[model samples]
Target: MCGLSADKIQVATGHVEISTITNHYIKTSSTYQKQLLELGNMDSINSLEVNKLKEIIMLQNQEILRLKERLNLENEEQTKNANLNGSKNEFKGVVA
Candidate 1:
């Protein structure tokens, strides 16, 4: 019975009617059932892998944003120091 309703079996097997499945396609093989279970397991494994990759990508993006902000702050500080040094040199030149 595969623990499934006749209508569900018919839909999955693409049979026109429940009677067709019960009459002609009712084979109870252990190997076939094992293969089906293995296929289901593969789907779950693939889903977990996909979720892990997405998490890694999100973390990387956050790190990139933090580094960019740090670079901008450093650049601004350098510009301010350069302006201050230029004014000091100009004042010394005028005095001498």
Candidate 2:
């Protein structure tokens, strides 16, 4: 299945020898082999999808941080403006 040689299969399966897989685990039937190959392909595809999702999550997290910083700066500016307005009102009252 999947065009891998017996030794390669043995290595992938963590068997010390190819005899274990050939004698017991693998089915020689065409349908079963095809299913195994399909499974291998799906594993590869799922890995790629998982990596892509991780990248998307990282980007969204960065955007959230940026937005939070922007909001914090806006709040600080508003607070400073409010304090300035309060001081001006106090000065006007004192002069009058």
Candidate 3:
């Protein structure tokens, strides 16, 4: 296990508060011991998971952009149709 102090661990992990890292993140007893033992392995796994999550977020953002563009196009078409219908109604009124 790394012999880092609580403050050092907080700084390294970018934790805003030492208590948060110690109290909430690092549980007590067997789980804590297991985490300490697999710290190096967990670091790699956590990094992989973070990268995967970022990729998923990027894909979701792209999908959202596409959907937004499609919605805008639909709205524009509807507006044009509405305006054309209004013009036809006005023409009929004028002719009568």
**Alpha carbon lDDT of each predicted model:** 0.85, 0.85, 0.84
TM-score of each: 0.54, 0.56, 0.56
Worst 10 residues of 2 by lDDT: 18-27
Stronger candidate by TM-score (1 vs 3): 3
Question: On residues 1-96, what C-alpha lDDT tens digit does candidate 3 reach at each position?
Answer: 156677777877898986777775556567877878877567777988889999999999999999999999999999999999999999999999
Writing each residue's lDDT as its tens digit, candidate 2 over 1-96 gives 567777778878888856677755565767888988877778777888989999999999999999999999999999999999999999999999
Name the 10 consecutive residues with the lowest summed lDDT in model 3: 20-29
| Per-residue lDDT of candidate 1, residues 16-86 (tens digit) | 97668866666546787787887677877787888999999999999999999999999999999999999
What are the per-model C-alpha RMSD values against the true structure? Answer: 11.1, 9.8, 7.9
Q: Model 3, stretches more than 4 Å misplaced?
A: 1-42
